[model samples]
Target chain A: MNALSLRNLRKIYNNGFEALKGIDLDVEAGDFFALLGPNGAGKSTAIGIISSLVNESSGSVSIFGHDLRRERAKAKSCIGLVPQEVNFNQFDTVKSILLNQAGYYGLSRKLALQRTEYCLKQMDLWDKRDTVSRRLSGGMKRRVMIARALVHAPKLLILDEPTAGVDIEIRRSMWQMMQEVNQQGTTIILTTHYLEEAESLCRNIAIINHGKIVENSDMASLLARLHVEHFVLDLARPIAAAPVLEGCQIERVTDKTLSVAVPKEHSLNKLFSQLTAQNIEVTSLKNKTNRLEQLFMDLIDSNPIGSKATGNK
Target chain B: MNYSIAFRTIVTKEIFRFIRIWPQTLLPPAITTALYFLIFGKLIGDRIGTISGASYMDYIVPGIILMSVISHSYANVVSSFYSTKFQRNIEELLVAPIPNWVILGGYVSGGIIRGLLVGIVVTLISLLFTDITVNNIAIALSIAVLTATVFSLAGFINAILAESFDDISIIPNFVLTPLSYLGGVFYSVNMLPSIWQNISMGNPILYMINAFRYGLIGVTDVDIQMTFIITGGFIITLTLFSLYLLHKGIGIKN
Candidate 1:
């Protein structure tokens, strides 16, 4: 069964601002799904509706086959949301926050305490359990939120930009922890602007722009759809001019570095053979941009008006 | 869903929040109550003499006690709930599986507890200046809870409409304090002209104070039965209104 399903979800703010036009999505159980969008692209609004934090204008939502409006308790019980911003009492201790969140989900006191301990330890916050939340570092606070969200052992986890302000090491650690949770058979839905993070962690992705879904496909299939990819190659010898190759574009970025754009239909062997004929040796090679990033940029460029709606705002 | 656990958790957290900052939450009201007794109950009572066959200090004790209950209950819910909104922590409860009534009841429970706690403290302080007597202990406690519940609901509405910290304080400073002080905490409304006394009857705090006073001193400027009816009606109305606001996702939602 699908872990979460939304049908024709719509949200119009009081000021006549339509945050979500109509969003229909489904994330199957045990899948790591990515919801990608630019700022104000209705990603947060959709999350808010699923979590019952915002009132929907019209639509239907279900989690594990329980209607969000009619069977709200069951629907909400199946989901855990870690919002884009830190949203816990700063004066509260980390342990108390987790314990309270567990309590909110109807966990018994004994169970709440046990889950609090387990989550705190898992997030590496056991040592800081008694510390006031505001006194902790940014990353520590983020982990505390994650631990709180996991305290109830929810079936579906939704993280909206959870690693936005976190440092690289902390981001990787969070990603690892999320992967561990996902592996434990919990369906995970993540929203982030970092395409690389989505590429590495999410198996399927949906890109939203101007409150509409622009792309939705499995990660591999979507990446494969990227026809053109740019590569930066380090040359063994300095070249005075850019290399010339049939059916390929090349530019000399620096005396020792060369940039090349190769289409998916073309082979790297053909480009290498042509370079070898010119007596040019390639020492190192790397993608100028990841496949997902390249695809996201191309999609955004193609739909400039929709992208601008999220961009300028 | 386990409603009891959800309610208990929210109540426990709220109590902890106030206890963790006792000097700020619990101490100031105690000090304020003491000063009110010193100036209005003692120094002023000595000059005013008898009011309704008892010492002025004794007559105003119930009013003063009700005042503390009103202010603390209103203040607790307003500051705590608004702070949650300001800090964006209200989403914790919003996203939880708990029912809207459970959330409202939990917050009102906290406010009632704080109001009663402060009332007890002030009542104990009033003992130093005046001999206290309760004609109906049940009535007195019930009235206190009812009054606290009413003010807590009012405060919740204020917090909902408040856009900033300044907005939270505006109604409390300009409206609540003025109404409470003039609600016959220090003087019986009967002492005023008939026209003024009729106008004083419009102040809801007057009925709450008089009902509490009737419970304690067995005398009230307003009819005791009508006082109970008004207070009970307000409680029911506000409870429904507050729940409606919460269910509508007003103020707290995106």
Candidate 2:
């Protein structure tokens, strides 16, 4: 069963801005999905509609078989949304915030308390539960939001840029926690600007640009469409100039670092061997740019303004 | 969904919100109302003697208590709802499965609670300056609750229409405060010239204060029956208007 389904969803704001233009999407139950988009690409608007914070101009959204328009309570109860901003009451304590959110979902007081404790422990915020929300660090506040969203144990979770300003260490920890959540059979839909995070964690991906879905496919399949891959190679020793290689583009980024662009058909082994033959040694290598990011840029570049691309499963 | 739990939660959160900042929500009103009793009821009333066969100090007690109810009720909802919107935490309720009526009921209940609480405090302080006797307990309680409900709903509408903190203050400062003072909290409408007395009848707060005064001291400048009609009318109209705003997501959702 699909955890979420959006059919012909549309949103036009009061100022005559069309944020969403008849977009369709679906995420299967328990799937880790990424809704990647750039700023002003309508990701937040779409999330806002799905969460019922923004009224839809037209179209339908269903969650776990509950139609959003006709069965609003059931649909909303089935999904949990972690908004991008810090939106909880600053004056509220962490525990109170989560418990109140649980109560809003109709959980009994005893049950809400239990869930609040569980979520706080899961987010590693148990010790800070009594502190006011505004007193917490930014990353801790983000975790509190995630914890608040989970207090009701909704089957589907939508995270909108949950780690936008979070430090790398906390972001990785949140990623691990999210993976645990997904492993526990809760479907997760994440919208983020960090392509690497999406690539690393999501099995399926959708890239929206200018209110339209330009690419919707499995992660590996989308990355496979990239014709060229760029890598930054750390040299074992300083090199005089760029290496002479056929069927590849290489540039000297520094005396000891080289940036290389290898076509999809060209083997990295071939380039390494050629470099070794030229008496140059490579210490370590990493992708210069995220592969999904490259494809995303290509998709956005190819699909200009006023162009619409149909989303595929 | 357990709407009972949701409603209780919203009410509890709102109550806690005001209680958490007692200095701001509960204290100032007590001190301000005490000063009114000291100056208007004691200092000035001693010179005016009595009106409607009741001591001048006792004459203003009901009006002062009801005035607290009106202003505090309106202030609670306006400030609380506007703060929720400003902080964007209102999405917490907006995204929930709770119905719009439940949301409306919860916030209004919070305002009513605060309003009545302050009303009780002011009544106790009134006792400090003047001997009080209830002419009709049921009528007094009924009008207090109804008056609170009316103002709470009005505040909800104001919060919905407010674009900023300043916008929230505009209604209470310009309209609500003036109406409360002119509603005869410090003087009787009967003391005014005939034409001005008729104009005072146009103010809704006049009916509420007069009704409450009749209940507490058996003295009223207006008919008690008209008080119920006007107060009930405001309640129904404001409740419907507030619910409509919530349903439309005005100033809340884009």
Candidate 3:
């Protein structure tokens, strides 16, 4: 059985906005699943429901096959949520925050302390253990939140936009730490606007838009489906007009360079051969980083599947 | 399974907060109740003689003590819960495996302790100005506790509904202030016209104060037994409603 499952999960706010509409998802054990979405795509709402922080209007959510409503405590025990907002008590020190969080899991003093210390050390928060959470820099506070979530040793850890607004150095360190944790048999679920992070870290991907899931599949398969590629050409001499390069489309006009989009299967080799034949000496050539984003944007714009469908099976 | 451990955790956190922020949470009520004792009991006791068939100082003691208890209890939960919301810290408690009732009860218990502590401090300060005779100690103590709990639950609900910092200050400033004063903290409801007196019977705070007053000096502006009934009823209702909201993840979830 999957570690977590949401079947036909629906969330309709009292204000008449449907933040989530029948989203069906599954996280198998030991899978690093990245949930991607634009702003207001209901990522937070989905996490809130699974974490038992928000109630669903209609749906079935099971953690390790335990129905959420029937076995709430058991289901909740297995899931840890690092919210998009750093929601720890600001007045509390890093240690106190983790300890209190463990206490809520009904951990005794000794066990709570041991777990607190371990989690804090793992997140590099041991040195600032005594500092009030609010006084820490934004990155440090984010780390504190991570430690707090992991203190109970939950089987499923959901990180909702954990690296948003964090510095690049902190984000990189956090990514490394997350990788180590994921390797230790915890089924990890991460949500982020950073597609690059999702592309690199997650083997499975699910993208939601406007409160609906648009895509869910293996990361490599989703990127492969795009089958779109781009290559830039450098002319040997300044050409007054745009080059008539076959199979390559001019994407932009810039001084001293031309940005071209090439379909991966249509033969970039032939385009390169043509450029060399025309004495259009290619000074530089590079593939656009994962053309999946363009495909995603195009999908979101034309069909706008996000509005009509809830999610795919 | 062990309720006491959970209870202890809440009580400790609350007392710590009270001691840490004494100037804001503890001192104000102690000072306010002390001034009431000094002016109403000391200066005025000399003019009025044995109002409750005891020393005039004794007549106002229960009101002053219960006043502190109610205000502190209300303030404690209001500020604590609202601050948690403001700082987004409630997620710590919300994401836990603990049951919702436990969370609500723990917070309510904390407010009860702080409210009672302020009540005791005010009672001690009042002793410097007036003498309070404990006619029925158990009843007086129970009433004070019950009153604090009811206000604490009310404050919790207010805090949950409050969306902004200004929202926190508004209810205390307007609704709570009016209700507490008009609840007969100073003068007896009997002094008002018959219609107003009948309406005063509807004010829950009056039942709380007069019930304690009945226990302290053995005199009440309203029926003591009825006051106890009303106070108990309000406490039960508020507790049930607050627990229901917590379980439902009402405003907190949003």
Q: Name the candidate that leads on TM-score.
A: 2
lDDT of 2 by residue, A1-313 (tens): 9998989898899999998888899899999999988899998999999999999999999999999999999999988999999999999999999999999999998999999999999999999999999999999999999999999999999999999988999999999999999999999999998889999999999888888888889998888878899999999999889988999999999999999999999998999889999988999999999888888888888888898685667
Q: Residue B27 of candidate 3: its Cα lDDT?
A: 83
Residue B166, model 1: lDDT of 96
User: For residues A1-313, what per-residue lDDT tens digits would candidate 1 score against the true structure?
Assistant: 9998889899999999888877788888999999998888789999999999889999999999999999999999999989888899998899999999998999999999999999999999999999989999999989999999999999999999999988999999999999999999989999998889999999988888778777778899889887888999999999999978998899999999999999888999998999999999999999998889888877766765544332210
In model 2, what is the error at residue A77, expressed in angstroms? 0.5
Candidate 2 global CA lDDT score: 0.93
lDDT digits (tens) for residues A1-313 of candidate 3: 6988989899999999999878888889889999877778788889888987788999999998889999987888888888888787777788888877777777788998999999999998899999877899999988888888898898899999899999899999999989998999888999987777888899887877777778778888777766557666566566666667676677535545677777667776787777677666667776555565665676567536445653333
Backbone clashes, each candidate: 0, 0, 0
* Pairs that clash in candidate 2: none
lDDT string for model 2 (B1-254, tens) is 88999999999999998898899988887898889889988888889999989988999899889999999999999999999999999999999999999999999999999999999988888888988889999999999999999999999999999999999999899999999999988789999999999999899999999999999999999899999999899989998998899999999998
Most accurate candidate by lDDT: 2
In candidate 1, list every pair of residues with a backbone clash.
none
Lowest lDDT sum, 10 consecutive residues, model 1 chain B, at B218-227
lDDT of 3: 0.80
Give the lDDT of residue B51 in candidate 2.
92
Query: What would the DockQ be for model 3?
Result: 0.51
